[model samples]
Target: MSDSIFSIPIIAGTFLLAGVVKGVIGLGLPTVAMGLLGLVMPPVQAAALLLVPSLVTNLWQLLAGPRFGALLRRLRGMMLGIALGTVAGSGLIAGPATGAATTALGLALAAYAVVGLFGPALRVPPRAEPWAGPVLGAVTGVVTGATGVFVIPAVPYLAALGLARDDLVQALGLSFTVSTLALAAGLFWHDALPLQAAGASLLALVPALAGMALGGWLRARVRPGTFRLCFFLGLLALGGELAWRGLG
Candidate 1:
């Protein structure tokens, strides 16, 4: 991998910021990292370069030791949906189709954020069965595979669950870890995982880990509503960037 003087510093800062956000909010690293990295590299390369750091950070999130079994039982159906959607989306990562799909995904996320900012209170009561997971998962997975934009419908569902802060963070971390791994595997199978890109991604772990540590500390003191608003706004900015890149 050829080293650019700017790449490492840029990626380091991006990962640091992403890690902090993810640490505080349970999700947003990938969205924030890729969005910022895309500014420095091609979108595809930026997405590929995030694989290792994202996976590593997620591993940390999982290790923070939340109730995985309980989380799975509560969201199994949605998980399955995510899996199916990711697989399907992975299959579509070819040529212009991928670009168009990613652009749409970006727009959708931006729209979702806007709604959250102004929309009425969203409530999806705990049900014996909630079918939204499958639907949302499919969409999220497809977008993840196609563009690495994987934070759309999934966030809303988790938000609606009204989980305790820790549980919510853990759930998001686990889901992202699984989904990112699946996406990476698909890319590898297709020979889309370039060595240079992978190497850069691995290097990003340094900043990501540091940021997570800092963010975790902050999470202990930050107000939930304030943190959530920041998270949503972050999404809005990143999502808008993606939309512009894809559409422009």
Candidate 2:
């Protein structure tokens, strides 16, 4: 799938649609893009192609908030843990065993959908966050290395931090940036990412950003919770399919 000329349209369409979802919901660009792209491409290659758009968009999110210094100071531990854990698990993806990585991606997607929709509303006190942040970030980093999906515990962890609405959004950006870069490092360590994939990843930014604009327009005119429900359902179904394919 990576070598085919047809992959270009697939990549663009996937990112554009995924960007739309992210613009509307304020998250899920990589999740949705990987889920869809996984159908036609290897998870490793798909993840590689995600680098440019994902990093660019996430950096935008990271710097968009007001409390970046405060957030960075607070999340530095988690960021470091993520980097370490990704390096630790760099061998999990790409290779003859990548089917396992695909299956992990599927499970991660399903888990994220479930958690996003009905997960517990646990709260973390300041003391707990100091320890919990690094632990959860490491766990998420392992998952990201294996599957390139990093939202599971990270999102829930941030949600529990008692941050304001906008702060939470910015926090997601920062966490995503770290995760994306960590995955990039992991792919590079495994020698799984190639120059062509990087070029494709760079090209993906145009459609992704365009789709985000469209989604933002829809966001203002439509209800967010309603869109979110459908989004989770889609993730559930896609995750199941990917898992089944991986296991088969």
Question: Using lDDT as the measure, which candidate wins?
Answer: 2
| Clashing residue pairs found in predicted model 1 | none
Per-residue error for 147 in candidate 2, Å, reads 0.2
lDDT of 1 at 7: 74
Q: Which 10-residue window in model 2 sums to the lowest lDDT?
A: 87-96
Report lDDT (CA) for all predictions: 0.75, 0.89
| Candidate 2 C-alpha lDDT tens digits along 38-60 | 88877888899898899999999
Best by TM-score: 2
TM-score to true structure, per model: 0.85, 0.97
What's the lDDT for residue 98 in model 2?
69
Please give, for residues 1-248, the per-residue lDDT of candidate 1 as tens digits.
Answer: 33788777888899999989877767778878766766555556766778888888877777686598898888887777777777666655534464665576567567667866776657677662477776777777877777676667777777777788788878887778878887787677767778888887888889998998998899999986798787778778877877777776
- The C-alpha stretches of model 1 lying farther than 4 A from their native spots are 1-3, 91-102, 128-130, 220-231
Task: Identify the runs in model 2 with alpha carbons over 4 angstroms from their true place.
Answer: none
